[model samples]
Structure formats: structure tokens, C-alpha cells
Target: MDAMMMDAMSKDMMSMPGMESMDMDAMQACMDACSACEQACTVCSTQMMDCAPACMNCADMCNTMMRSMMRMQGMTPAAMMAMLDACIAMCQVCMDMCMAHADESPVCKMCAQACQACMDACMAMKATMATA
Candidate 1:
């Protein structure tokens, strides 16, 4: 789903000033990571653990980040960079919180891993934007 969306966005991106050379692969990876993180956090949030609130908040942020990436027409490079930073920060906090109970909760372990992956993907997107 995201691949098709990214493909369509690629055309729009080419016409946008300062985004003509944007890395579609990095964008796709970031979106995919956000989607995965959102799912993981949603499940983890149901675990009724200490990290539930953080997991729920992270899930919301990830969804917002993914949606913003999908609507490239509404995004400037600066705005996108800011969103990525916010996503990364949210994921970091969620990951730290989840990791605290990872040993006792499988859901938390999975959530933490997903958060780490999302953070990495967001960072990669930031680097791609920097080079572009």
C-alpha cells in the first residue's frame, strides 16, 4: 500500500522545489517503519503495563508521521525534518519505557524492537533529506 502511495508521491516530489532529488527509498522505509511501530505500540498498549501510556502516545505519533509523509504536497523539507525528529524522540521514549519490562512481557519486547527500528528509519530519512 505504502509502495504504491510512494510511487505516486514520487511524481509530485519531482515537481516540488527542493524535493526533486528526494530519496523515495528512504521515505518508503520510514513510512513502513512508522506503520510497523504503530501496530506494535497499539498491541503493547493493551498489555496494561507501565509503558502502556507511552506506547499509546508513540502509536499516535507514528500514525501522524506516516500520514504526513504520505501527503508530501503539504510538507516542506524543514517540516518533514521536524516531524522525523519528533517521531524519533517519541520512539526513543517509548522504546526506553518498553525495554524496562521487556524481560517480563513479550509484547513490550516486541514493542521496544519496533520502536528501535522506527527510530533508525527516521534517522535514515533525515540523512537522506540532508543530502538531498
Candidate 2:
């Protein structure tokens, strides 16, 4: 999304119960990372490898995480934290599975990198929330 759109969404989120101190930039980055990870996992899942199921699960989790962040009015701080943790865990599992075949499959390598990026973004968001 564009800066104007993210700013607009952030402004709307400011009205939510626990979003008063939310970091819009960090949130946007996390959302972007989730989107990228979802796309990478979707492609990886079509490879029929051992990691396919994990990639599929991670893709779903990332999409849900991104959507939840977009709809902050329906989320509590605790729920958001839990969801981030879940996204991180799923990404880790997917990354590990993909790395096992990374040498043989270029797609798996790409998926692993995407998973790592998603995990980093989620961690950054969590850190931002902690100080908020």
C-alpha cells in the first residue's frame, strides 16, 4: 500500500482501544512482509516437496496476521501479540522445512528467505508494541 493509504489506516486505528501508541511504519512493514511471505509460500507449496504443507500453513497464517493488523478495531493488544507470535512460529517452521531442500530447489530457497524476512518483521512489530 502507499504511504497515504497507510497513514489513513493508521489514523483510523488510532481510535481503537489499544492503538493509541501504535507505530504505523512498523505495522506497514510487517504487513508488507506478511504479504510477500504469503506469496512466496503459495508458490513454494505448489512444488510438491516435504515443506509444501508447512508453506501452505505459513501462508494462511501470514495472510490472517496481515488482515488482523489492518482491522485493529477488532484486536486487543494481547491478541495482536499472540498472533504475531503465531506468525513467527509458523514462519520459523516453514523456513526450517524449506532450508532442508534449499540446495535443490530455488523456490524453496526463496521461500525460506521470505519466511525469515516475515519473522524479522513480526519481531520488529512486537518490539515496537512492547515500548508502546
Candidate 3:
């Protein structure tokens, strides 16, 4: 992300207790990672396999996560926790589905990895919130 965007995000994130300590670079990386994962999952879901449903779910959750971070003002601690749980649940489902076809399909393997990464990022964010 650009410096101006980082500055704007900092201005917005500073009001949140734990989030205030988050480095701009780390936040930007997480946002980019989520976006990439969402896109990968969406494209992979078009294959019409059992994994399609889980990929669809993961795509929705990742989009929600990105948007929630973008509009942090609307999020409370309780709401953040709930969203985190939902994201984790969706990621788990996606991972399970993708793993079933990972040996045969490169896309499924990549999708599973992306789901895992997104889950890790969400967990990191949730941990920060808990500490706050």
C-alpha cells in the first residue's frame, strides 16, 4: 500500500486499543494476503467439485474480513470476536474440502494453503484484540 493509504489507515486504527500498536506494513500485508486468497478461492470454486461449496464460503469470509478491517469504526470487541470465529470456521471447512483433492489438483492445494494463511492472519488479529 501507498504511504497516504497507510497514513489514513493509521488515523483510523489508532482509536482501537490493541490495533494502535499494529505496524502499518504488517496490516497491509495481511490485507493483501486476504484479497489474494479470496480471489484464488473464487476462481478455484468454479471447478464444480465437492470443494466448490467450501471455497465459496471462504471467499465470502475473506471479503468480509477485508471490509471489516477497512471500516473498523463499526466493529466492537464482541463483534470482532464473532467475526473471527466465523472466519476460522469457514477456513476450516475450506481446508478440509480442498485437502480432499489436493493430490490431484494444483489449484485445490493452493486454495488450501491460502485458506490456512488467511486463518492464521485472522487468528493473529484476534489475539491482538484479546490482549487489548
Candidate number with greatest TM-score: 2
lDDT of 2 by residue, 11-32 (tens): 6664347657688789889999
Work out the TM-score per prediction. Answer: 0.92, 0.95, 0.85
- Angstrom error at residue 93, model 2: 0.3
Q: Local distance difference test, per candidate?
A: 0.88, 0.92, 0.77
Taking the tens digit of each residue's C-alpha lDDT, what string does model 3 give over 1-132?
Answer: 456776765476644433454434545666666787799799889998889988998898888877776666667667767987898789889988998889999999999999888888878877766665
Q: Least accurate stretch of 10 residues (summed lDDT) in model 2?
A: 7-16
> Between the candidate structures 1 and 2, which one is better when assessed by TM-score?
2
The regions of model 2 sitting more than 4 angstroms off are none
Compose the digit string of candidate 1's lDDT tens values, residues 1-132. Answer: 445555565476533344766677787888899999999999999988889999999999999999887777778888888889999999999999999988999889999999999999999989978876
**Clashes by residue pair, model 3:** none
Between 2 and 3, whose TM-score is larger? 2
Error of 2 at 78 (Å): 0.2
lDDT measured at residue 108 in model 2 versus the true structure, 0 to 100: 98
Sort by lDDT, top down from the best: 2, 1, 3
Write down the RMSD of candidate 2 (Cα, Å): 1.3
